[model samples]
Target: MLGPVTTSDPLLTDRTPLPDGLDARLRDHLTFLIEVDKLKTVLRASPLAAADRRENDAEHSWHLALMVMVLAEYADEPIDVGHTIKLVVVHDLVEIYAGDTPIYDTEAGVTQVEREEAAAERLFGLLPADAGVALRALWDEFEARETPEARFAKAMDRLQPLLLNWMAQGGTWRTPGVTADDVRARKAVIGEASKALWDAGRHLIDEGERRGWARQV
Candidate 1:
């Protein structure tokens, strides 16, 4: 049976002369890192704040990590900022293998969940055994959103693209068949973790509709 997952291992750091078996562990961990770098190549539907181009999965994850650091104060209850940051950073790593699914693409259907699970298995399995187990557990926690940290992390994840779409004058919102209601339905979880942030987000949605930047169904 697999042992309990641990976040720390000698494979994570340099050691003089290294321990027996350390080389194989280090190679496994390094291979995971190198493979996950493909996350930078997975383009997302949301554009960057600068509006010059679409943001990739790695950029989206980093931006959400910063939001966790800066916006934890608005969480519905006090939270562990570090844990939330970790959740955000690793939550999207599966996209490196699964590819991104835009929020507005209702036609993409339910198969995405299955695809991401397979991706998570392959991507996280690239790490050393313990590290792979730990990361897979973390990714599942974020997906479940059954804990406060996961909920708050999910709030930031939903909010980032909302802000971006607004910045782009309705970005994917302007895409055919997307509407204000669709955006709200996708973003409603923001209210679960942070009412203050939800209030702010609702105002943006209202403003977008008012400006005709986002269409109403």
Candidate 2:
């Protein structure tokens, strides 16, 4: 039988003194990774496509990342697909700390900006200085939505929940105050990214109305 591995072995301890600043930087990187795992438990209002349970921030981000990859060609303008993927993936990291705020919560939305800004700094600050800077910039870019990558990323962000709500037979839309018009208004920006996706989303909305699952505008 092979000998058991030992933590004290030279092979394990042979790592050279990580250059002066590298130890702290690498620790920061690792700490950030562990901290972000909290996102998996921060649940959103939207349910999984086929599951009754609500999806969490991490799953939502992962779905949007995959959506960006598969739907890149449908973007209205040429975009950096790679950058868009990063934007979608990183966009919700703040929610791990800030907690998921529902879209129609206008009062919460008003405060969400401030709360998430603080959360962004604290969460991204876990990374090495340079890495934290890059991620914070990407998070801000996704928020501003001025660039094509940001726009497309935002589109996927909006579309995913719409598809899920429709598939779940009007998940959040079933809330007493939510109406088909409310859904339309909230999701309007999705058209700016990809007309094709918007069209499909519209069809889903229409079907929901027809089935009396979602309210008519």
Which has the greatest TM-score? 1
Where is model 2 poorest over a 10-residue stretch in terms of lDDT? 4-13
In TM-score terms, candidate 1 sits at 0.88
- Residue-by-residue lDDT tens digits, candidate 2, 35-76: 677789889999888666899999999999999889999998
RMSD vs true structure, all candidates: 7.1, 9.8
Off by over 4 Å in 2: 1-22
Per-candidate TM equals 0.88, 0.87
Inter-residue clash pairs, candidate 1:
none
Candidate 1, residues 30-74: lDDT per residue as tens digits?
A: 767766767889899888887599999999999999999999999
Worst 10 residues of 1 by lDDT: 1-10
- Model 2 clash pairs are none
lDDT of 1: 0.83
Candidate 2, residue 14: the lDDT equals: 27
